[model samples]
Target: MGHLWVIPAGPPLGSALVEKSEVVIRNFFLPFLFIRIGLLTDIFSIKDWKAFVSLGMILVAAYLGKVWGSLLSLIWFKTSTRNDLLFGCFLNIKGIIELLVFLRWIIYKPIDVQTFSTLVLFNLVLTAIVTPLISIFYKPRKRLDRISKIDNCIRTLQSTLPNSELRILCCIHHEDNVNGIINLLRASNPTEMNPICAYAVHLIDLVGRALPVIVPYNTQKRRLVANSTDRIMRAMTRYSKGSGAAVKVQPFKMISPYNTMHQSICKLVEDNLIPLVLLPFHENGEFQSRTACVQNFNKNVLSYAPCTVGIFVDRGLTYYHPSNICYNVAVFFLGGPDDREAMALVSRISSHPGMSITIFRIDLLENSVESENDRCLDDAVTKEFMVGNVGNTRVECHEMVANDSKQLMDAIKKEKDFELVIVDFAEGHMMSLLVIQSVESIKQGAKLLPP
Candidate 1:
């Protein structure tokens, strides 16, 4: 078999879970022995020394059985000590599996007093505590290519969907521009999916009452929470038609009291397993600072969101719908994993079966570079992804004679009409300013007339 096929799918829950898995592996005897001790702790059980000795012997046998089996295989197979030890440790993590065996024995009425009682309490509490953590380290086999593209998938979605509607999650403060946003969602001809959902997870303090955050136990109390979320959704749906691409409002619980709005938005996306259009108000100034988004906050909800997070600007260069005209969309690539991912995403969106794209890239031209090779020019777009040019479509790797950010913007504005200049691999802060300037130009209706 190929080395790739042998590779496990990701270790989910990341380093924290992995570290815990290692702990579970290292301290392999404690939890199990404690469970055995718990069975002996029962007052109705054996009152003699022989009974305790027998129980201890069985525990010792099981321990040696696992450790010896691992050591023998490791020494015989002969790889690295570290690898062998890790494999041995990983193999002996039998919290859930052992309990399952014990349960089955009890069901058949064949289990003895000691084994039955030990396994019962073991499965119920201690094993339950640690097994899930151990399971995190082992993953089902999958392609490395697939793993590299999408980070941790919370759940693999069964129903494949073609997204059409611009899904928006509106956080209404005082509800001023709320109507405008709803109207925009209503106007768009979205397919199959709902357009917008105005959700309000309000922060409130209940006087002289404290609700415990206990799942399954708090099921009855959670029904009241459903009403608020349902009401907002109904209201948004009411304004537009109750069905089809309609704007809907929803509210969720402020599950974590201290979670920042950004992180909450991210977590909400992850928890629900959906792409969320975040409608945060974008002003004429700079966007929210990185620190402000998720700093000093104990938990980050926004950082770990699975799906695409779209932040819609309230005003300024609105290119949400750009009149369906061929505009120069110049993409910059700096050559890395991030750049590669960006290229892949763009190619998926623009490339098709027969048609070509008017893709542009930046290149530096230098004279007297080389004799035969003369490889001074840099073509950022990889050849495999770029198809041949057709009609008005041409892949122009613009030789950088002399053009900074503003100059590049001016050149594109002066030379050709563009829907929106999408830069793929830019330094984050610099990109923000370029985007703002481009938006301003769009707002002013300044035209280059004709190139």
Candidate 2:
């Protein structure tokens, strides 16, 4: 009667209720109830007054469905209002059901792939990003810190990055009262802790008066997020101290899974330039697992970036697992000013000892002239892309020209699923082209890659 979906997922809450509550999305298990009860039969199919009632019911359901799901999550999961809103938005944003609808409509198979994907991506992106944003951006009065100059501090600390030229650098807190923090840095920098390199730093804390209340930190019993954090820190410290740090397990206070860690790392970045953050991963099935910061950073801040980030999933500081995680990387090139900048980014992390890289010319096209002058420019284009090597990752220039950027994106999309998509998106020019594809992909519900 409220015309809303609760969770929008999982098994039956009973057919009688589901039949009336299925709304418009048919892929979910409840849609069968809508059909069996004939709620959508003559009303929707015949487009009669019955259909009018059904449509009204569906609209109501979507709204209530989202609300119920959010409220339930907040209560059952002990999620903060911010997390509950995010969870509700994620649930109700609606998509697995979208595919079944498209399948039903696939009789009209002459669909535009990019255009269709764009609509879907745009809808989902707005819902996913914006729905929770309302909750995240507006916060209670208690959490605001007076020190709002973290960005300036970030700049000052950035200049102090150790081995600014090295492929991999570890910034540690060799003498912090926060044992967990110290242990983590210690494990990650197992080589030799350069006492001068590690220092204090901070990021724009998630707790802004303007932002929503944080996910409750003290709810540590329900497989708390910080448990994994401790494991990661210990691993890094052990690696840094070379089995010598002998740090025993000690429980730390509750930590914010995503935002707090981001701020901590940002603070660290102010003093140390560790491009990669090695986070501990517990197999507890969380999307924001070890790479939460990576995803968060890519989504919220990388474009405004001063740097690129690598998120580490710890596998203990064993002799076999050393400091090596992902030494292999891939870079995309479009042969533009941004492509040149992307190459410069490669310089920061390429110095690692065993990193191997594959560079792709997703698309490069120059007018072929009958005269030699055209050929001269083509050669220059090739030379412009020649960004030597960084550390162990030998930059291999893989060249292939496409009819256009969509085709290039298509080609790259079909290739291997990469950990990251590095694009040379220097404003204007082809950057506009990528923006279109990005929008289309986003509309179709794909996450955005760092530009």
Candidate 3:
């Protein structure tokens, strides 16, 4: 029993005895003692009216005093009301000390049997109520590392200048996320003037590991922490090499539980001062259904991410053919922050020689032309690419109304084929951009591409 208390400061020795055995201690040691106290307690002893009233009044005063003090401290410190109540409840908890003191009072006959029983019952009731209330109200505070200060003043991402760097944080887990992301990076067409810095984050769910690990592949540390993550790093490295000129890639492997992984990603984004975060869409496709944990992780990241987030819905552009090849891409703009960002990315892709792009701007039948307030810089740039020779003959622009998918597909069916479609993450109007192709149609679309 004495040896059980000896704990080191790290790893298997300290973690197993202290961290891992907490559940056992909570369930067995504490509950057994509490049950024993309950069995020893006499319920009928509280029937004495004078003793009951006196003990109840004392208990109420003590509880209110703790609550008042906690409320004052929380207010003075400007803490949240939920935490204020939780702190009060935590302070009100009567653990073994209270029980022991009361037991001593009983042994010394400071109170009669009825009074003692009432006081004990008061202690137990207050403790029970406080424990549950605190549990309900308590939430852990969000903490960020030291890296959140860089570019913290910037509000939104802007278009890169000729000499500017476009920094992106890309998150991936499954191999299914590989193709579309690589294609999207290719579309960016990093050049000598305006370079691209992509941080490829391979998020792995921590299992039986004692500590979270962050492994950087840019260093010469060749010890593979995880095999699957190693494969992802290698693939990203190859992609980076094949993408010539100003494309730089740094692979990072993070091992954390899914519940807290979003926080890690946010810290990474803040540290890197990344302007954009690309995440895989959380819907089930033909290959795999999204796991509940991963879906929840995605939701949390979307909610708490420090940078602009784009959820890519990969509709099998690379699934059919080699990702190294150039793709026929289309951009659908429905007018929102996300759509603007998508268009800005596509504008960069238009500069690539091997890429062919078509911009589809959706318009309402009631208003064929966009209002002044609705027009943005992204719209202006797309229009410039349409008429000007910046992209020369590679880019084309078209306008569409409510029912235009049928017409657009038919038009593409006539002369050319579109391998990938990039659209904003929006509902109703933008969803029309994600057109499903049958197996036969996919084969036909592939044939239309130049060999």
Which candidate has the highest TM-score of all?
3
Give the alpha-carbon lDDT of every model.
0.39, 0.39, 0.64
In terms of TM-score, which candidate is stronger, 2 or 3? 3
Residue clash pairs of candidate 1: 198-249, 199-250, 233-249, 263-301, 263-302
lDDT (Cα, tens digit) per residue for candidate 1, span 182-287 = 4334333332442434443432111112231211112124353344334443455465455444444454433222333444555454455554333333332342
lDDT by residue for model 3 (1-451), tens: 2555555443335544565777887788888866765665777766768767876898799889987888887657998776777778878775787877776776688876677678777887787777877666565424432223334424234444435778878888767677677767766677767788889988776654657776686534586464566667777788777767677888898877778888888878767777778776655555244366676776666656655666666666544223345667777666655566666566667677777777777764443455565566656756665655453777777776654545544544554557766654333221112222222243233222112
Q: After superposition, how far is residue 381 of candidate 2 from its true place, in Å?
A: 12
Q: Give candidate 2's TM-score.
A: 0.35
lDDT of 2 by residue, 125-189 (tens): 55676666656665532231212232422232123344332222222211222333343333323
> C-alpha displacement of 6 in model 3, angstroms?
14
Name the runs in model 2 displaced over 4 angstroms. Answer: 1-227, 243-268, 271-298, 303-328, 335-342, 345-355, 364-395, 413-445, 449-451
Highest-scoring model, lDDT: 3
User: TM-score of each candidate?
Assistant: 0.35, 0.35, 0.61
